[model samples]
Target: MILGRSAISMAIGIWSIVEQAVAQHASNNRAKGAPITKNVSMTRAVYTKLLREKVFPAIRKKWPGRKTTTIMVQQDNAGPHVQDDNADILEAGQEGGWDIQMVSQPPRSPDMNVLDLGFFLFVAVATIQDTFDTDGLIAAVKSSFAKVSYHTLEKCF
Candidate 1:
């Protein structure tokens, strides 16, 4: 899930859940060897596209009346996340004369991330109560994200 926060408001930018699929082969009515599972982890390219295509647009739509055009995006310190100098992200931020900056969270500080400590927990609880397949799980998680209150997110700060 992607979220935007400021002094006055907090909004969910993008919430997505992807499933990993495994390829299995049957041999003589028995399973043949181990299944090959495709990696579903987020990569730098995917994150960059998310920032450019999803987060930025949400920021613009949600905060069009804000006084400042500069938006600072705080991201977790993950290997797939983009650096501050990513060319595509920088260019996207510069669209419509807005300044967009990517900021990394401090190392070894899980509590510092609002999403990890708060929103994700809510989602996990909401999802855990339901019995759903992969597609259903994704839908339920997205619905749970929408159900989260902005006040709850604000309290995470």
Candidate 2:
């Protein structure tokens, strides 16, 4: 999902890369006609694509005030994550005169990466629901994200 916010705002929106497809093998454990959820591996190419197509647009759209606002996107030091100055990302960030840069969290500093702490909480809340299918699961996640209190988000940031 494309997650980041000003001190006053919530997440931009929920955007999972999951896709639905027919299950290759039916298991006795699964309910009849249950949907299958496939998670995509996050590669650098995939990550860069998301930044160009999803994150940059969302940030530009949701950011409050001023046309020339500069934004710093803070992410963890994951292998799939792109460098701060990736050419394609830099091009996307420079679009329409905006300056957006990706900054990685320092190594060996899990406490500094609070984004994951809150993000995982959202997942925990989502999984608590008795969702039966992809649509139901998506609804559950959206509901959970919607319920995130400003006070809670304030603490996370």
Name the top TM-score candidate: 2
Best lDDT among the predictions, by candidate number: 2
Candidate 2 residues 16-82, lDDT tens each? 7777766666688465456778777889988898888888888878874644666777777889998
Candidate 1 lowest-lDDT run of ten: 30-39
lDDT of each: 0.69, 0.73
| lDDT value, candidate 1, whole model | 0.69
Candidate 1 per-residue lDDT over residues 35-130, each given as its tens digit: 433335688877787787888888887778752667777777889988888888888988887786777778778566765677778778878866
User: Candidate 2: which pairs clash?
Assistant: none
Question: Cα RMSD (Å) between model 1 and the true structure?
Answer: 4.7
lDDT of 2 at 110: 67
The deviation in Å at residue 22 for candidate 2 is 2.6
Q: Report the lDDT of model 2 for residue 23.
A: 69
Model 2: ten consecutive residues of lowest lDDT:
1-10
